[model samples]
Target: MEFDELQDLARGVRQKYAAREHENYGRTWSREEIMLGFLGDVGDLAKLVQGKEGVRPREDLDEAFAHELADCLWSVMTLADSYGVDLEEAFVSTMTELNGVLDET
Candidate 1:
């Protein structure tokens, strides 16, 4: 699916979590809280990457690696949505700039 579609799906997932938070914690997570969660996911993803590279041992291996990466992506999409960022546009623009810099080298 497109990035926008994926972001919409992430929003739906966030809504479900929000409802649960309201029931369990009496409040949904703030944007900063969500960003912290994203940071946790990033840490998990880094470990998975290390395992995949043979720098660390991991029994779960393949499935955990892919899952953690997806989790990180979901967090990124949700965070971008929260900030009103057009991630697709931002990604393309950033990559274009990077490519330009690489070509200049």
Candidate 2:
């Protein structure tokens, strides 16, 4: 999907969970939880690397990578929701600058 489509999709997903947050009237995930999720996904990526060296099929490796990435993205999305950050805007702005730097290099 396009960037706008993806952003809309994320908004819908967040809305679903945000409603639950409202139902319970409890806080969303904390910063620590988001950070832990990030670190855990990184560890999972490393494990996939090790597993890749084993006799596992390529499909297994791809599946593992996809799931870990999705988990990491969930944490990021949840974090953005809690903090009121616009994830798509941040991504575009940061990547624009990063791309400039890469071009300079």
Highest TM-score among the candidates is held by which one? Answer: 1
Candidate 1 residue pairs in backbone clash:
none
lDDT of candidates 1 onward, in order: 0.91, 0.74
Give every collision pair in model 2: none
Tens-digit lDDT track of model 1 for 8-45: 88899999999999999999999999999999999988
Point out where model 1 deviates above 4 Å.
none
lDDT of 2 at 64: 83
lDDT per residue for candidate 2 within 1-105, as digits (tens), equals 775676567668767866776688677544786578679888887787777777444666878877887777776776775688888889999999999999999
Candidate 1 lands at a TM-score of 0.92
Quick one: best lDDT, which candidate? 1
Per-model TM against the reference: 0.92, 0.63
**Residue 61, model 1: Cα distance from true site in angstroms:** 0.9
